[model samples]
Target: MSTEENSGALPLPQDDPVVSAGLDIAMRWGAALGGPEKLKIAFEALEPQLKREHQLRLKQLDMQREATARAEENAREAAERMVRLAQQKRQHALRMTGLWLGAGVSFAMLVAGVYVARDMWWLSLFLWGPSLLAMAKLYTLRRSDPGDMQAVTLGMRSAANAAQQAPPPPVP
Candidate 1:
């Protein structure tokens, strides 16, 4: 054999076509036994990649669960803060009402003390004078400002009633 044939170089075709066809068939058979068998080998190699994708999806779901829990905690805290603010407002309103009532009572008691000391002999005018003055002052205050604090409305109503129930005007 020549040096080219020994080194497995290309060879010239035979003159007979029938002999060439038979040689081609024998070469194909030899290749079927010597080379890789299955044509779907690339598809088989993708199994591990599909499993890795499933693991990544599970990790994403865990992250979403943690985020949802944090949001719920924040919402609960906001609701508690709103309730605390509402309670503070209610306490402030009650304190304002108490102050108005205390002012009304102190003024009324001071007037009564003055009248009782003035009429030492006759105890009758002393008893009615302070009450009558207090009622008159309350009515005048209400007429001066109609939209004053709502807390004093109860006392204002009683003063108005007392003024009306007093004896009517005598003939001139």
Candidate 2:
């Protein structure tokens, strides 16, 4: 109640009588309980439980880390499988296109050779010879390794060049 009694105490924003009364009670209780020593003993009793809880939390964190790593590895493997499947599909399409083109060209050349044989024997030889050579080249291409990127690129370039040299479609 006197200023001397509150000297060492911090100034309260509001001079609440109830707050001062509660603080006084708390100080008395603290002194009766042997102050810091009782609190230290309470904490020491709780040490083992706190350590067990900490170890459990660390184990949970480790498990979560392992799960994340496994998930990432699975995702990576799935992505790789998708890429490989796409490459296989592309190679299959190219092979099918090559087969169809080779068959059509050979058939067309044979028909033309037969039609031109009686009139121009030399033209027939030219047509049939080129068709045979083209077939032989295709056979060699099929026999070669499909995994070779350089061979695949060369084949694509040659096809592009042949397309460029081909005559344009007649206007409608």
Candidate 3:
């Protein structure tokens, strides 16, 4: 440190009644800091650590945001899957009801056709043909659709299925 630069930098406050006021206080503080150049160097030296901490905080926030978004997306997808499964179940119930009704009607007609066969053979044939077709359709229909409900985690479901399918333990 140069003697001229270091000598008498920050003057102590005088023991006078008159306050040195704003400019005087500022000059004293600036002199205590050694100069504007050293102040600049101090700030420059501290900036990298401050900047790194700021970036780290921002990265943490971004990670949290991304995780939340992924969770919401997974929830949304699960909800959609549930809705689709419910719709499919509703449609299946409706189809099964219709098919059961048709089967009942056809079976009734077949019985009626047998009673009518002895009286009017041609009329019985007319009723029998369509009844047979309806029965055939009911019997040939597939019970399950190709697109069945898929679970993300089948832990409980698989356990239940296994329990149901496994042979009962011998009564001890």
- Assess the local accuracy of residue 111 in candidate 2 as a C-alpha lDDT between 0 and 100: 86
Clashes of each: 0, 0, 0
* Ranked by lDDT, top first: 2, 3, 1
Q: Which one is best on TM-score?
A: 2
Residue 117's lDDT within candidate 1 is 46
Model 1 ranges with Cα > 4 A deviation: 1-44, 120-172
* Segments of candidate 2 deviating more than 4 angstroms: 1-35, 139-172
Please, what are the lDDT tens digits per residue for candidate 3 over residues 120-155?
A: 555466556643554545544633332222321233
TM-score (all chains, Cα) for each model: 0.42, 0.61, 0.55
Cα TM-score of candidate 3: 0.55
How far does residue 6 in candidate 3 sit from its true spot (Å)? 19
lDDT of 1 by residue, 109-163 (tens): 5566566544331232333344444444454343323433342464455545654
Residue pairs in candidate 2 whose N, alpha carbon or C atoms collide under 3 angstroms: none
Off by over 4 Å in 3: 1-38, 134-172
lDDT of each: 0.58, 0.71, 0.67
